[model samples]
Target: MSLGDEHDGASAGGGGTGQTRTRLPDSGAGDVYGVYGGARRPARNSRSLITVVGVVVLLIAAIAFANRSGDGDGDGSSSDAPAGRAAAPTAATGVKPVAGKNGTIPSGYAHDEQGAQSAAANYAVALGSDGMFRQDSRHAIVRAVHDPAVVDGLLGRLDTAYSGAFLKNVGLNEDGSAPDGLTFVSRTVPVGTKVTEQTGDAATVEVWCTGLVGLAGEGSTKPVTETWFTLTQKLKWTGNDWKIESSSQKEGPTPVNGDNRASTADEIAGAVAGYGGFTYAR
Candidate 1:
């Protein structure tokens, strides 16, 4: 899709304030993709029903499983009481981490819809970052952000995408390295999040985001371009924590931007490396 399409309702901003003047085409309520503000109808494929059923089954299973795990009361005794009663306090008690403990990453996300939003936002930031462009850092970033079940698959594809030849195509050095005196930048800033559906133990959150990606060097071919995307995450409360189960992303609800002076390569690089990333709380 075109970067500035109005139908998708995506907007671009000069800075991180998230102000946008454009309006998106309206689709009536209850439309799936309409959540993003587009009129385009979803495909009338046979898989739609199957997909819905599968999601329902999964949700049911997750809720049941989470409920069956009795609350910790020192002595392990099972309770058949309403699952909601037990799950509520556990999910509610955890405080969202305000600052990163050891580094830039935020910690202490509460195990609820808010925590799911936090994870989705931060995960989006990690996924769209420059770290995904290098080999070792790419693996670290993916492992840190993705759900365990899909980590292997995601890592394999990421490895291929950031392979030596691919970096060359993107004007990087043969070893998937950046040229001297240049810094490549990639970062995603989350705009907002909405909990589409939520239960005591599970939640689905949509994180709208804007991303900057490109090389920053003198005479660079693609000097810092911008794009928008929304990340949808399914989160489950596991091991007394909230963890992402799976996530999918799509192109923007973007708007146009006013002209602004671009920062120098060294400046952008220094900011990225120097400034720490936040651990988000919804």
Candidate 2:
């Protein structure tokens, strides 16, 4: 079974990375895919805790781009030669290297295509994170990433979807916290991003992601595991930045299992705490 199947609500941030957005290529290199202000999605053909969690995960997550300067004008550089060629006036984001935060999530993205991709990439992290398990953080995330128009309705639905009963089934306490000795993990890291469609006011982006879910430590039935999925986010220019409109997800472009030895729960927990998540999501 897939890692995310049994555990509907997935895991965290603070792992290694930055992701540039682009959809997966047809070659099976990756499979692909939002945030809160997000509209209530139309009922899907398939529905599960994973599906709900996947969609919800995108609703809260964060982003980071390695080669690109997130702080500048989308120009290749901060000051030097306008970073190769300056963006055409119509396309120039003027604001790059997104800054600030919305609660613990990233905020203040540029107003261009790259910005949309970055916002989607980063959002997936929040969506698939451990935050979804708890009520307080979950509410804050919904407010930060979602469009204000849909937030009220979407909030009610999400509360029902992530009920205490659901959390218990997934091995979490009713409060969405891990068992006293266990470490819960549910982090989604974007592999890449692609813009499938775009217009002046909106964009549809696909983010291919690798996610971690489950728990670690003694007596834990839900061992932390990995997952692959693609998420599609419908984004709109709202309140000066891209916010979620609607979203969807589907399984892999997953790779074959590798030869690497799996880590112990302690090791996994250590890694989660030691490493840092990328900054682009903001």
lDDT of 2 at 14: 14
Each prediction's total of clashing residue pairs, residues at least 3 apart in sequence or on different chains, is 10, 39
What lDDT tens digits, residue by residue, belong to model 2 across residues 1-282? 111211112221111011111121221322111111111122325457786787567655522232243444543212122223333322224555566788777777766666777788877777666776677877776678767886666555556655665566566789888889898776778887767777777887778777776678777766676767777778889998888766666666677564346788888888888887664642
Candidate 1 wrongly placed segments (more than 4 Å): 1-104, 259-282
The CA root-mean-square deviation of candidate 1, after full C-alpha superposition on the true structure, stands at 16.3
Q: What is the lDDT of residue 46 in candidate 1?
A: 41
lDDT of 1 by residue, 101-120 (tens): 21334544565555666666
lDDT scores for all predictions?
Answer: 0.51, 0.59
Error of 1 at 227 (Å): 1.3
lDDT for model 1, please. Answer: 0.51
